[model samples]
Target: MKLKFSEGVFECIENPPQFFASLGNLHDATIISVARTAPGGVCFIIGDVFNNFVDFPEYPGEFGAAIILAGSTDCEWTVSASHLFGKKINDFEVFPAHSADAKYRLEIACHAMDRYVMNFDKAEIRIAR
Candidate 1:
């Protein structure tokens, strides 16, 4: 999968190894870290936000950390604001758009996916999908 950022940054890693290398750099640079789940799918990690991308059909919408990231391999890649959670680590603040503390939290999360943030509201991301 590929990621598109609002700052004109676009990245795509075709294999697991490449994904690892990119993730390593992001981690080392204190940028963002993401990993392809061993079983399947992908996960993005930030301070308390750990968002996992799952197939839409398995979970139609956000119920927690699990979210619909993409419709299909060839479909638009998307993320929902409602899907972010940090309860696993005891941080319960859901990523919000209007909060002074979270205005750019979504953008930070996107960096983990190799995507830069754009403006949007709850339950949806700005990325075209």
Candidate 2:
């Protein structure tokens, strides 16, 4: 019932739109639990947040948090959990490890100020002049 916050998680908030790179950053965290953000964004509760809550039957896993590579340097992440994610808790001992890994989905939140992202793909088509 004691899960400590590893330092790297801070990047999730500090970096903005960039992912926390390296699995070890999460303490080799097996599960990347997800929550839908109130602002159409997303939130992730990393690592064994469930070990303490499973018996009560709650909280969420990983097929993983997928990394969306934008061009060459930008990256975004996504999350997907099993039906049992927030329900039965851990995967059955009889089964191979299925959930409990780091992975994610991609959502590009181009807010009111990102002029570059908002127009990065636009083109002015014109006949040869």
Candidate 3:
């Protein structure tokens, strides 16, 4: 998947070996780190995982996963299985319309699974303006 940035500063990495052993069927995992390019942009970190499957004689097309992140805003973002498994790790530097000091929040919605796991050791966020 492709992550759109507001400005001309953004970067991405797919399944870094330091964090995960292999992408395997878990292709939907991503580590998104954002930085502030201008004075009005904010930076944050997002880690997500998604999985879909079917149970014999029980459930079909069942899905489960978890989302995790850290930042300074309170806005909510939706995540889907396709976006998680289909996209790559996207890191970016953005320039928002608001001030850099503005409130920022990160929300992670964990699906079918009871919990979502994130290895912060392999993920981070930095802001410079």
Per-candidate local distance difference test: 0.27, 0.25, 0.29
Highest TM-score among the candidates is held by which one?
2
Clashes of 3: 9
Worst 10 residues of 1 by lDDT: 66-75
Model 3 residue runs over 4 Å out of place are: 1-71, 80-87, 97-129
- lDDT score at residue 46, model 3, on the 0-100 scale: 36
Could you tell me every candidate's TM-score relative to the true structure?
0.19, 0.25, 0.21
lDDT winner between candidates 2 and 3: 3
> Cα lDDT for residue 114, model 3?
19
- Between prediction 1 and prediction 3, which has the larger lDDT? 3
Model 3 agreement with the true structure over 5-103: per-residue lDDT tens digits = 122233332223322222222333333443432323333333332221122233222122222222334332354333433334322222221435432
Higher lDDT: candidate 1 or 2? 1
Tens-digit lDDT track of model 2 for 1-129: 221223223212222222132112222333334444332333333334233333443323222332212111122223223221333222211111122331222222212211111101111111110
lDDT of 1 by residue, 57-96 (tens): 3322221212112211211234442333221221112233
27, model 3: CA deviation in Å?
15
What's model 3's TM-score? 0.21
Please list the residue runs of candidate 1 whose C-alpha ends up more than 4 Å from where it truly belongs after superposition. 1-31, 48-72, 75-129
Best-to-worst lDDT order: 3, 1, 2
Clash-forming residue pairs, model 3: 1-87, 11-91, 28-84, 28-85, 72-104, 72-105, 73-104, 73-105, 74-105
Best by lDDT: 3
